[model samples]
Every structure is written in C-alpha cells, then in structure tokens.
Target: MTYSLPRQLSSLLLATSILLWSCESFAPRPPPQRKVIVTGAAGRTGKLVFSSLLKQANFYPMGLVKSEKSAKKIIKDNAECGLENVWICDVTKLDSDNEGSLPNGIRGSDAMIICTSAVPKLRKRHLAKALLKAPINMLAGKKPLDFKTLQFYFAPGQHPEKVDYEGQIAQIDLAKKLGVSHVVLVSSMGGTNPDDFLNTLGKDKDGNGDGDILVWKRKAERYLVESGLQYTIIHPGHLKDTPGGLSELWLDVDDNIMMSPSHHMMSRCDVARLCVASLKVSGGQSSSFDCINIDVPEGTKSRPTEIALIEFLDAETTYDYSTDRKLDYSMNI
Candidate 1:
C-alpha cells in the first residue's frame, strides 16, 4: 500500500508539470543583435548615432574615436553609451601605410557608419563680423544665424586629402576585410562644383589656396560606390543643430535643394537618425541622395520611420549621385 501511494503521487506531479508546460506559447528565441562600428562617434552626428544604437534592441554599436579626449567627452555626453563601448581609433593612421588595418577591438563588426570628417572652424575675422551683424539681424526680425556670411578654415593636418580621401578609403577597405555587410557614409553637398566657397577654405603650407575638400569627398564617395557593398550615402547640406523629427525632412537631387531656401539646410539629428534607420533597412536600395529639413518651426508630430525611408528608396529606384557633373551657383568670393 505504501509503494502504491508513492507511485500515484509521482504520476500526479508529472501530469501537473506537463500541463503547465503545454500552456506555454513555446516562442522561439529571438535573433542575435548586430554589431555596428561608428567611426568618429565622439563627434556630434556620430554620438547621436551611437546613442541611438544603444536604445535599439537589434544593434550593439561600438564608438571608434580619435583620442582619449574625444572618448571621454562622448561618454560624458552620452548616458546610454559608456566608456566601455568607445575605442580609440584615428582614421588618419589607418591609411595605405597600414594596409587599411583597424584596431582589434572593432573586429567582427557587421556594419560601419562613417561620420568622421575634416572639421572646419570659423575664422576670428568672421567672428567679429557676426558679432557686428547680430544686433542688426535682431533689429530686422531675423535670426542672427550669420553663419552663411562666415568663413571657415580647417586645423593643421586635418585636410581633405588626409581625412576625407585616404582615411575614408582605408575604413572602407577595413570594413570589407572584416566582412562588414553594410556601410553608411555621410558626405557633404557641393561636390560637383570644385570652386564652391568651401574650396577656398583649404590652404597650403605657404597659405596658397588650392585645396578642394569636395573633390576629396567625391573620391571617397566614388570609392564607396565602387566598393560593391550594400551602402547608403547621405549628402546633407548646411547642417544645423536643431531637434529632429520636428521638421519636414526632404530628399532631392544634388544641389537642387539649394535652390529652395527652406530646404537647403537640415538638422544633424535627423541625419543621425537616418544613419541608424539605414542599418535597420536590410536589403535597402543602395543609393546616394541629398537630404534637408524644411518648415515646421513649431515642430511636427511625424517622426522618421524605416517604412517612409524604404518607400522613398523604393520610389527612387536606381538613383545614383556619383555621376552628376552639373555645377550650381558659384560661391561669391
């Protein structure tokens, strides 16, 4: 009688366990997250992309910076991405001399977002000009964003040849070497016209003006296009530090947006969001287009989504910005 009671109890327990298990949905495990590398993640646009990646469940991004100083500031600004995620990587060093090599910490990355660029600082002479114009602008009921009239120059050793061309080509080769499936490159507008005002900013050792940053940028973009990897190349004009999604984002053919004053400039935040969105859009149409933000100073309720981006890409099937030879208005010297 005692053995019979024990056997009945064991059968009851097994039946209960089986019933509980059967109630489960039996959902399979989710797919693993993708690893993305953001070069120049310490910079304004790069940090936004890096932080945005942290929020997404599908991606794990690592920030590749140029120095410890950059790493610290980015980590401080980004509460979502900590120091652990940032890696010291100077793109200038990853040239032909090193065979397009990269630091080991960034290996096994599935994608790369190239936000690095040769930064231009406003000249002191323009600073005084802006200060003089600010009061007059305010009196005329206009925003004192005198940046259009301002002139800028790059720091030493931070030219287009060094950073835009050689450095970017190196990164692309490295990405290919590391088996990265996708690459998103952020290039600027005015590439078709080498005589644009920005070209005047480039100076030689003896102060001879002969550098055309857009030319170097075009070289890099051409290299990326020929790289044969799935890519999304964005050419944003006159980047502003405004909030994203609040403005109407517009995409158009090169230098065409410049014809419209409202659409000639865009928020950097929106561009960064697009960078993250590009990653989400697997099998996306690989093309180069110009983007800008327009209207809605009071803010818009419509946020940027992958669907809208995909639709735009699908509609503009076979779009290519690499072969445009039309030069727009020349920058007044």
Candidate 2:
C-alpha cells in the first residue's frame, strides 16, 4: 500500500504538470515587435526619431545611413542609450550594381521614415568667393540676389533626381516589396507651386528648373500615397534646432503656412516625434499636411501635445495643388 500510494501520487502530479504545460504553450501571445527603419538616421531629425523609438517597448528601430562613418558616429553619440541595429545603405544607389549599394538586411522593414534629402554645396571653386559675397549681397539689399545662380550644386551623382526622387522611389518600392505597412516622409513645404523660390536652389544653368528638389520630393510623396501602403507626408518649414515641446505647432493643408509673409520653422525634435507616432496608430492613415513650429517665449518647456499629434493619424488631409500661387519671398522674416 505504501509503494503503490507514492507511485499513484507521482503519476498524478506528472499528469497535472503536463496539463499546465500544454495550456501555457497554447496561450495567446502579444503581437511581434515591429522593426521600423529610419532613413537618414544619422542626421539631427533622424537621431531624435531613433532615440524616441529606443524608448518605445513595442517598436524595434533600425537606421539606414549612407556611410559606415555615419553609422559609427551615431553609435558613438548614443553610447549611453545604445541602439538595436544600424544598416549602411546608400539610398541614392539602391538600383545600382556599380555604386555603393543597399544592404540586404533592409528587405523586411515594418515601417520606414525617410529623412534623406539631396544636399546642395557651393561649387568648391566658388565656395570662398560665394561666402565672401553672400553676406555683402544680403546687406546691400541686392534686388536680384539668388544663391542658385552660379553658386551651389548638388554633389556629383547626388542631385535631387537621384536623392529626393529616385532614392525615395527605390526605398518605397523595396519597402513595399518587403511587406512594409507604413511610411512617413519628411519633405519640404515649397512643393505646392512649381515656381516656388526654393526650386531655384536646384536650377540648371539654362534657367530650366531641372533639378528642383521640392518638386522631386512631392513626386515621391505622391508615389507613396499611391503605393497602397499607409503613408504620412509631413512638409515641415525651415527646421530649427531648439527643443520641440515649447513651440506652438501649426498644421494646415497644401502649403498654407507659406501664405504668410514667411514660412514658419519647426524643431527637428517635434518632427521626429511625429514620425514615430505615424507607425503607432493602428491601420495607418494615408494623410499629408504642412506643419511649422511657431516660436514661443524663451524658457518655455512642456510635454508635447501627443493626443493632438495622434489625431492626425486618424484624419487624412487632401493636398490641393490647384490653389498654388506665386509666393513673394521678398520679406526678411
């Protein structure tokens, strides 16, 4: 009786253990973490977005940078907080076999925040001369002053068509191919008008607006909107380096901010936060709007209006280019 009783007890305990194990194994699990890739992640705006993602428990953030050097710098700067992963992908050469290319690791992103833009540099030969004359020209109130005239040009192979248009297109196509569900594009506010003064920054020698960056950026935004993926296009005015929450944020449709005497500026921090928010809202909203950070009093510091920003994800804005008008950029503001 003694041996039989102990054996029966052991058998009963083992059976109960197995039953519990089976139930636990079959229990429902939370959704998998999303791997969100931030292009231009080494830049000021991208850094903030990446940092914010590091704080989020549900999202896994990765960065796609143009060079290994850039990737290293980001890691070094974020030594305390650290990063999950950083991929080196030359967005401009995603389609090229001959140029620096995209890493294969980029194939399965859940969302992409594109902050890459074509950068204009004063033709080195003209850098010194341009630097000397630019301030003088501004001070003199020169009526015909234009930085695009003979001064600046996109570095070889990095023009607007390559970066803003083709680079963005290639990224979008790859993201779509990889089953990405959402995209948040960081673009400019001057695209509503074809003749917007900022387009002059990329003017060709023949005065033809061949390399207009904002035009290319708008084209990329349109492509994302039509790509069937949930998308958010944010056209921020001039970017400021100040803290984000302190500023008053204004959002409008179709370049409405430019209707004022001067385009309002937004902090890189707030734009980054918005980019992160785009992926958090379920079933992303395919919306596009222009936003600017209105300056507030100094020493102002408050938490961001997160609920207001999230509202944008549920309500979409229609971009109407038919209202484009000639914006006079004569103001010093």
Candidate 3:
C-alpha cells in the first residue's frame, strides 16, 4: 500500500466535508402541510370546522372572520386553539379587509372553507332599500331595482340579487388569486331543489315567495365549478345544536330527494367532518360533494364518514339539475 501522505490527507478532508454537508443539506423534507383558511369562523358551522381541523396535526387552520370581535368570539371556546392562527377576512370587502390581515401564525395554507350567510338582521326591507337600491346599480353595473314598495314583500322577502351574486363570485375569485387550489363551500341543501319547500323561497319574487337565497346559491355553485380550483360544496340540511349529534350524509347530483329513515339528521360535527375529509380524496372529488341529510346513523358518535363525498361531486360531469340527493339515517339521542 503505497499511499502518498499529502494526497491521502487531502482525500480524507474532502470525504469528511462531504459527510458533514450531507448531514446539514441532505435531510428529508417534512411533508407538505396545508395551511387552512376557515371563513365564517364566528359562525357555528365554521367553529365546528375549525375544531375538526385543529384535531389533525398536519393542518394549520386559520380562522378567517369579518371583524376582530368575531375573531375573539371564535377563540372564546378554547383560548389556545382559537388564538393559534385566526385571520380577519371579510369576503364582501376582501381587497381592503385582508390587507395584512392574515392570521399572525402559520403558512402555506391549502384552501378556505366559507361558512357565512347573509346577516339575519338584514331583512327584506333593508336588503331591498339599502343593498338593492339605485346606488348599488352604479357600483354593481346593474339596472335599477325592480320592485314596488319593498315593505309589501314580507314572509319570504326579496333580497339583493346582484350584491349576493357578485359578492360570492368575487370571493371565489379572490381565493384563486391567493393560490388556494381547494375550496370547500358550506351551502344549503334546498339549493338544488328549486321546488322544494326550502329552495322555493328563492324563487319567490315577492316576500310571499320563498325568497332569493337559492338563486344566489346556485350562481355561487356554478362559479365554484368554473373557478379553476378544486372545490367542494357541502349542502347541509337544517342546522341544529344537538347533544352528541350524529347525522348521515347522502351524496348525489341533480334534485332527487333521498331520505332513508335509518339515517338521522346530521350534526354540525358530521358536517365539519365531511368538510375536512373532502380534502383527502383524489381528483378533487372528495372536495366537491353536494351533501344532504335524510336519516340518522343510529350508533355512531360525533364522528365523520370515512367515505369521501368529493368523488361524487366531481363525477357529475353532466349539467342536469333535477332530483334531490337524499341521505337516510336516524339520530341516536
């Protein structure tokens, strides 16, 4: 073994340097963690969705709210959990509201779940006069409001069609701009069935009719489909605050009503569960299910369904919008 002393030393040093570099630079990267933005975090559904996301260690959930007050309310339940990553975001005014407004902590978020609805305080009269007046026409580039004495519309009142339609579409646009590829929207079950009691209100021209919420929802759903991002629309039935609530979810396209007595009404927890699960399914199908409650799951606790609903949502390549998708189950009280 004739080894040159200087050459052997140089080789040893080079090998040592390479080994150190490997330790510092060649380590495996952590899995891609999704940063979640949960809009309407102040609402009941948003709250539940936030809680479920928090349970998953990988997801860094950020609660997106309209006001600091709403941000505070969400954190009241479990201070540590709520305060972690709460962003102040109002979709109605996304441009100005979200400036430097993302939650302080967390990064690389995957998508946003919008859970808010029109404020209950804004009734038909206010919606007509304040939201749908001529001034809005100037801002929204729409024609004048076409209704006589907004007061005459009661029970099922008239709503601001343009405002809602535009606002929701704008929000979806903003989400895409933020590089969010997956969005989960919490819509209403009646949205699909225009003739159903729940959806009928939207068709009502006057207050006597069901109202205009459904039209807006339908528009939003279509926009989501065209938004070019992976999306899921969860249309839950009547929302209730029940103890140990567990509901069955049925996935379908069109307006077919399928209610099996075996499945009880769904709980907020289940809805939240489904929302999170949608993200896991491949091809974004797990992210776009049109879900509704009909029956209850008798023995289950407040757990989520393992079956990914997004698959069904994406499978409906056709545009037929008749028949209600039904879920049948009985609630275990």
Which candidate tops TM-score?
1
Per-residue lDDT value at 67 in model 2: 83
Q: Could you tell me how far off, in angstroms, the CA of residue 149 lies in candidate 1 after the best superposition? A: 6.8
Select the stronger candidate by TM-score from 1 and 3.
Answer: 1
C-alpha local distance difference test of each model: 0.77, 0.74, 0.61
Q: Which stretches of candidate 2 lie over 4 Å from their true place?
A: 1-31, 80-84, 95-102, 123-150, 204-210, 261-263, 295-305, 313-316, 321-333
Better of 2 and 3 by TM-score: 2
Residues 79-144, candidate 2, lDDT per residue (tens digit)?
A: 533544788777766663432355666556788888898887656676566667877887888733
Top lDDT model? 1
Task: Give one digit per residue, the lDDT tens place, for model 3 in 1-333.
Answer: 675669889999999999999998978878766888887777888888887787787777888777888777777765457456787755555542454643344245678787766532324565557454688776778756543323222222214243345556766776776777788888766555444443333333433532456556766777787778877777766566653234456665443433433332456777887777777664444343445554444665422465535445456544343322221111010
Q: How would you order the candidates by lDDT, starting with the best?
A: 1, 2, 3
Ranking by TM-score: 1, 2, 3
Clashing pairs in 1: none
Look at candidate 1 and tell me the lDDT of residue 17. 94
What does the lDDT come to for candidate 2? Answer: 0.74
Clashing pairs in model 2, backbone N/Cα/C closer than 3 A: none
Off by over 4 Å in 1: 1-5, 8-26, 95-101, 125-151, 204-207, 261-263, 282-284, 296-303, 317-333
